[model samples]
Target: MKLIGSTSSPYVRKVRIVMAEKKLDYRFEAEDVWSEQTQIASSNPLGKVPCLIMEGSEAMFDSRVIVEYLDTLSPVGKLIPQGGRDRAAVKTWEALADGLLDASILARLEATWPSRQANERSQAWIDRQMEKIDLALVAMDKGLGDKPFCSGIHFSLSDIAVGCALGYLDFRFPALDWRARHPALEKLATKLALRQSFTDTLPS
Candidate 1:
């Protein structure tokens, strides 16, 4: 098995973290999807990163699908709950975290396009996304509450997804200062950073 993605992508990082936690061995191929030479389109029509390729099976796309499939392959460090309401809760957490990342990336991309920034309407759209991120941060802080991890007690996919989202914010939007606004999230990030999986896969 092998994974193809860039280190800077939060989506890719989430998949990598799950792979590490599960102790799954696979070749990490760094592919720049933006590059003309990238084979991303072959595996994923959307030309996205974090495509997982198995020896004989079809390649898997999307971090959520890939991670969920990988979780089933090993019971060792099960990041996802087996089933029931528990599984749904973890999936909900993942949706929120991933949605936060999606919004953040859109805003950042819009900011990079100076012409878009100059347009009042486009700028307003960007602002809306930023506001979404702010609200998501507050919700994440409150959702976490006093739990050690997102789901409480054992560390799960909720932690991995949220941790990667926070890490991406730090890497791309350092001025956001999420830590100052959410101290509980700060501690969660601190604890997650200590994990070998996180340390090994820290975005450059």
Candidate 2:
């Protein structure tokens, strides 16, 4: 098995964390998605990062699909619930967190475009996206406040998704001080980081 992605991608980081937690052995092929000669386009028609190529089968793209498949591979430390309302909650968390990351990444790339500058950027749009992100963070804190994990006591895919989202905010929006403002959320992130999965897969 081989995983194709770049280190700086949050979605790739999520897949890497799942692989580590599953204790799976697979070759990692880091590809620069922007390069003209990159293989990502061949493996993934969408030309996306975090494409998982199995030994002799079609590769898997989309972090959600890849992570779900990985959870099925192991009976230990299940990252997603088997089936129930609990599963729905976990998926919802993952969706919201991933959405926040999607918006942030778009805003970040646009801000840093060669012809673009901070002064030329639209603070109004960025602020609106951030408002949504903050609201999601607060909702996550309220919904998963007492639990050790997002869905329950056991760690699930939600934790991985949320952790990656928060990590990206720290990486790209350092001025926000998310940890300080949201201590409960920070605690979750801190605790999750102690796990080998999170520690090993941190974004570069």
Each model's lDDT:
0.93, 0.87
TM-score of each: 0.95, 0.93
Query: How do the residues 1-204 of candidate 2 rate in per-residue lDDT, one tens digit apiece?
Result: 899998889999999999998888888999998887887788999999899999786889999999999999988777888889988889999999999898888777667767776788887877777788888888888877777878788888898999999999888888988887677789899898898888777778
lDDT of 2 at 197: 82
Candidate 1 — which pairs collide?
none
Candidate 1 accuracy as lDDT:
0.93
Error of 1 at 164 (Å): 0.3
Position 161, candidate 1: lDDT: 98
Report the number of the highest-TM-score candidate. Answer: 1
Query: Model 2, clash count?
Result: 0
Error in Å for residue 68 of model 1:
0.6
Worst 10 residues of 2 by lDDT: 106-115
